[model samples]
Target: MLNEEKSTEAVSFDTEMSVEKAKDAKKTLKRLIKLLFNQKQKIIIVLFFAVVSLVFTMTAPLIFSKAINVIYEGIKNVSLSGVFNIKFDVIKELSLLLIAIYLLSSLSNFIQQHVMAAVAQTLVLNIRKDISEKLSRIPLKYYDTHKKGEILSKISNDLEKVSDTLQSGMMQFITAVLTIIGSVILMFSINWILTLIAFLTIILGVAATSIIGKKSIKYFTNRQESLGRFNGQIEEYFTGQMIIKTFNMEEEATKTVETSNSKLYSDEKKAQFITFAINPLIRLMNQIGYVLVAALGAIFVIQGRLSIGLIQAFFQYVDQASEPLTEAAYILNSLQAAIASLERVFEILDEEEETPDAANYKTISNPKGNISFEDVKFGYGKELILTGIDLEVKAGQKVAIVGPTGAGKTTLINLLMRFYELNGGKIKIDGIDITKLKRGHLRSLFGMVLQDSWLFDGSIKDNISYSREASTTSEAHQAAKLASADYFIRTLPHGYDTVINDENSSISQGQKQLLCIARAILANPCILILDEATSSVDTRTELEIQNAMDNLMRGRTSFIIAHRLSTIKNADKILVMDKGNIVEQGSHDELLAKNGLYSDIYNSQFARSITAKAL
Candidate 1:
């Protein structure tokens, strides 16, 4: 029973912190590259443009150096009193060429940015599309195990991180690498001694950043996972506020959320501090490299080992070499986080999907209301929930299943609908093995009204019509009328079109139950399973709905799992189940005569009703 004895798995901080950094990060990065490489043409174009921009940028410094030497040479040769013999035409031409080079570099940069932006959006779109399809393929059992908000965070938070990295982080990383490479080559060509001095300090900064980056991966992984854990608590508690209020446990819920929030804050703070801490240190080292190059170049100029023009060009190269690292500190940080998020999304995509339907699967056009469970044995895991269950219901029989909590009543229904596959048994519908039939068609034969009423963010008409896509508005209204929900629906604003969601308080729990019943009525299946379907409705409304359900179940094979034994007195047969086995089976009168478990339970309920009325 979904309502009782719920033992749920909580999101634990210790579990989130245990993410395997070395193994998973490397694997995730490899997969991400493979996914990105699928857009081979787009990547190639972006790379080509980025390289072109780097080439143009590198050439500008050299031209400026040549112009500077020309001016310096003219100054040295001329007397103080005479006109300076600077090669004005040559300097002017070099200046113009440098300007053109800068313009071209900017243009290439713009083209790459534009193209990469498109590629980024396309990559995430394809990933999100695949995720959407994968969601439909996963089995219902997966949902039972995972938290709602954790799963939602994968779609919202994790994907957004990936999208952001792809959009800007990727482009920045590419450009930064190219800038470093081009600048180093130009610096070496100008003066190897100055280049060596500048590169030593840069290498130090790079080494430090590398060490820090490796250490931050674990924290980044934990922070993202903790974010998912926090989201799970918020979603669970927010959605279950009514239960908290009913049990007067508001303070408890708040404390639980506060614990989760504190963990998130701690993780986030550590992640951010470590990620951004590399920036200032990198800048300091690069600044030292700049000053060392400047001091060394001045000595070389005095010794006539290098010209003023060459020293100026070497300074430009050093700045360009260090610039990428200075900016890339945060890009590297974001890239690490994005890679972690990518791993989470991939984990979901790689989860085992539901069993596939056989080729040319059979279908039942008009199923007779006969269901037989033959020596059925099943379990969620290794331990069996339903053991050696054998039962047969003839066509048009109204069967009531009476059981204590965890007695496998709902499990039996789940098997009949094939929501979970059996471990060692076969179930047949109308003498045909259910496994041979198409799963969708097999499930379509049964209509279900569970205790927990499910309504999405849609209109009353939409919710009712969900069972049958082709059902018309009039058909929906007719079904609603039969479920005894038509009158209250008409009283609402916008009537059948009023939207339903968690925020809406106008629709009562009884109304939600009525809507679910209306949906089942619209399905109009040959087999009906009502697991405490009328439990939420008031006594008077339940009576009216019961009368309506009896008419609807006239010829349909129905199974009712009810808590109020008075409601099932007229059932065609009553099966008393205990601890996953049927203890006794008979009509209501026969069971009462035997004075078995069913009788004792019925008497207890009767006593409760009498006592309540007397009070």
Candidate 2:
């Protein structure tokens, strides 16, 4: 008895959860509809067509009903010249009216479908643009956490589903409701008793739809989630294909993909099965309703309570009623799927964006790049990466930040660029608080070269001039020469016009870095940031790059983050960072004499280069 009670309790808990979920689903559906219809001005054209289609659909059964009554009346009273005259020439007139009704219905349906298609396309285009704009405003951390494939799924698959709902499902749903309403009124006019029976069948169908629809919605949500995961896994695997081969982990990679694929397939199948069941079940119930209506109508006619014409019209009304219920079942399933997609899209759009502070400050006309960080504290989250990093760099002074891996050197650069806000203290440039300056104007003053050199799929010339506007060919060539990239660039078959594919092409990593340097040089910013700029180059290439860097840093205040100590040995000041704190700061000679963290790192790096040369 206790076990039975426990089971009952568990079932009751599940029931309550299911009810809550259903309520949430309804809310989500309503929200999605509101979003779709909010662009009322743009959607009015499509709505007009939808309304016309619905009216025509509703009138189709009525036309047939009227024709049946007219024909019955004509047959009841035959016309034979002087012998007899038909009360009304109902057959001839009804035939002509039926033809006109069908023609009008066809024309309206054609126009409605065309308008709906146009509306769906337009809405999809606008939605994609809106998503893209929203993504641009979102913080970088959001992209860092999300997978590329998952984002793509939202823009592609989810948007496609929304389009499907708009183009077909929405129209079907409207027409179905109108048809149901029309059929019900006509049925009541024919026989109230049969109308009551029809109502019971409809209610039963609705109940079944509700039960199956809940399961369908749950499964569809799961299916979309699984698809996103599957896409993410596939993207990750392909991105790391080289690593998998080097590690001899092909089988492991395959297994991982297989597992993800299996989960996706299972979820999809389950959702499809549940959604598919709705229409068939509704159709079965509809067929039963049809049979009951026909039998009862025949009985009424035989009892002399109903005319033959009235029975025929009643049968037509039953079929019309059943059609809408059948369509409603299908449309409800489709609508549930669309809601799943819309929810995912909205999830991204609703994410918090980076908020810039409300402060307008004087624009730096000729920024001298005098940077100061006073007791700065920052971190990714709870773990503090930078603590009390007090530092200053005079105008045009070359500052080098040297640190062990994960010692918050890059975090400092990120803070300077305002990519992440500092938890404590202030960063100022030219005696003005950076937080008060517009990010766009502030970033425009800095030329940054990251450890990983990124090149878009475009011509070399295009890559070199990827700033605000296209650079002149002569200007691009000059920048390339300053970066020591012009020599190899000219040797290529297409030279500056040679197209490079995404992170691919026969070019070496050193060449890619040089190209990136050229890009930064073309921008001609007052402040330059070189982060492991020559880390991938050989000794000869490094010397060439060092010369290029010397030319680039001639008139600019530069911040160099280098693992190679020799490159920054001549810096005006060297700051040694350890666990988010500036433990030591001095010139190269001064730091060497102090024999601290900076000295140790410099010696280790210099000795390694010497040993490599000896070997």
Task: List TM-scores for all candidates, in order.
Answer: 0.94, 0.90
Query: On residues 260-324, what C-alpha lDDT tens digit does candidate 1 reach at each position?
Result: 88988998999999877888898888888888888888999999998888889888888888879
> lDDT at 562 for candidate 2?
87
Q: What does candidate 2's lDDT look like per residue over 494-527, in tens digits?
A: 9999999556758988899889889999999899
Q: Per-residue error at 208 for model 1, in Å? A: 1.6
Clashes of each: 0, 1
lDDT of 1 at 529: 91
Clashing pairs in 2: 385-580
lDDT of each: 0.86, 0.79
What is the alpha-carbon lDDT of model 2 when measured against the actual structure?
0.79
> Between which residue pairs do clashes occur in model 1?
none
Misplaced by over 4 Å in model 2 are 1-27, 42-48, 69-90, 357-361, 610-615
